[model samples]
Target: MVVVKGQDTSEPGGVPAHPAASASADAGDEAAEDDRRPSPDDLHELLAERGLAPDDVDQMVDVAAVGITARWWRNTKVEDWHAGSAIGALSDVDMYRINTHTTAKVRERLRRWRREQGLHTMVDVADADPAPLNRVFYNLYRWFTNPNRTLIIGTTLRDVVAQTLSNARTHPDCDVPDNVTTETELEDYDNQVAGAAGYLLESMDEYDPRSVLYSPALFATVWARRWWGLPDYPSHVDRVFAVLADPGHRTWQNRPIPPPPDGVNLVDVRKKMLTKPWELPDSVCQWLINDAAEHYIFD
Candidate 1:
């Protein structure tokens, strides 16, 4: 795919004198004025004269072709793979552009997709059942291959928290809560929430089985806020955990209905409940109820 330019090695009559002809003045003079052009071999010699060895020229051509092939494959094959699903209907050219996208561009697109899918944090993936988890894996896999995919996959609670914070940072309209502007502040908040969630999940034996089952809804409410672009204040975060820690303190309801906070759009929440209530796991439902109760108490 690489073309190398040849240097002109013509003499006065556009002919090159043969080596043997140079032994005699008369033969050299006759060959010099022959007016014949150089052959392929003569061109090679001319290129060599310019310091480009045959082997070096071959290597350069090969390297250039390889680089072109690699770019084409990355921008073609990967793009088609993503187009296989209804949700991923990007054109070949669009996918190619995405393949070559800068980090900020990729993150912006990823944030939009997350918003559309209502996926706020890595915890959503971590706590997902097999079906949801597989969907998440497939979505991520379509964009990138193995080692790079690892960058988005979270294996631990801490990793999930870190990923959640990272996503928040990428969101253009993100409204970080007070005390959570810097990396250190965000990490501290992550630790607090993770510790609380872990303690609640682990302390299930201490609470009534019915209440413990209901506790998942409490966590779900917190997760839901993330989907709605609402900030998770420390007080509310601690309160959700506290309620989970003491499930027996309050009666468990079949459904916990939380009033939408001021400025929070209820359209998506309402739509999900009306059309896809099953998507709201029991934990999320409980959190909704507790959220309503807390709102009432504060009011």
Candidate 2:
């Protein structure tokens, strides 16, 4: 939550304020603040000084960065979510003060940083099988809900998990495992989800699926899609179209969608869906932001 120093910080009606609204309101102040904030490269150098990498920052922050990946819209409504998530991610480092990498940039950093640590991306997972995805989530759910496990249920991660489970359980093709088959079963696990965004690998063995699946691309996309009321399985055109066609499913109010930026092809991008935006050109970052703001979620 973005707390203004002199304003009422209480969440009116208990509904979290929209990122765009908060961001737009604070744009002038944030621009001044950003001047004092470390650049992404500076942040990386600081992390290296303290023997940490981007991955050590925490998943929630990463997702938030991905949500507003491009610096193109900094100091705008787009920057609001980024500011909160980045600050939260930096809090985990105990040394560094901030992070500003997009999902693509973060993934690139991971590909390089993790390689130095002898970790590589999973290349053979031909399909994003929800069974494994659910299993990974199920374990994370267990960990998050466990009182013995000292974990802080940060806002971003809590929102991500809640949204992910909702997507997994509702997507027509999803075959949710019996263990986590019902909303009540999991809802009973924990009542209040709050705290600084974070993750703990201590209890997770080397072979744990989260080692590969607990990713912004893999896990956080659910939360990202939730912005536009999109469900899991981006490849599922039928479901995606169904959701798009239904006025009721548009969680946010309907708005005028502007023409996409030149040289940007939404169809081509969708065809290559889940291609890991960072792996492509930097423009993919721009394309995603354009799609989200002008075409999909906001206008």
lDDT by residue (1-299, candidate 1, tens digit) is 00112422221110012211221122124324535423324433543453333223222222212212122222222222233222222333332223223222333443444455554443332332334323432343343322223221123223323444444445453433445433443233333223322322332323211111122222222222221111232345345445534545453345443434545444453454333333444344444544544322220
* Maximum-lDDT candidate: 2
List clashing residue pairs in candidate 2.
154-195, 154-196, 154-197
Clashes of each: 8, 3
116: Cα error in model 2, Å: 15
Taking every candidate in turn, the Cα RMSD to the unseen true structure, in Å, is 32.1, 20.7
Residue range 1-299, candidate 2, lDDT tens digits:
23334544432110012221222223223323332323234333443453334344343234433432211112222122233332222121210111122334434543443344343322222122324433433444354444343222233323433444455455453433556522432243242111101111211232232223232222234224432212223434334434444556553356533344578666665554444322334454444444333124321
Runs of candidate 2 exceeding 4 Å displacement: 1-3, 7-81, 84-199, 205-231, 236-256, 279-299
Which stretches in model 1 have alpha-carbon errors above 4 Å?
Answer: 1-181, 205-211, 216-273, 276-299
All models: lDDT? 0.31, 0.32
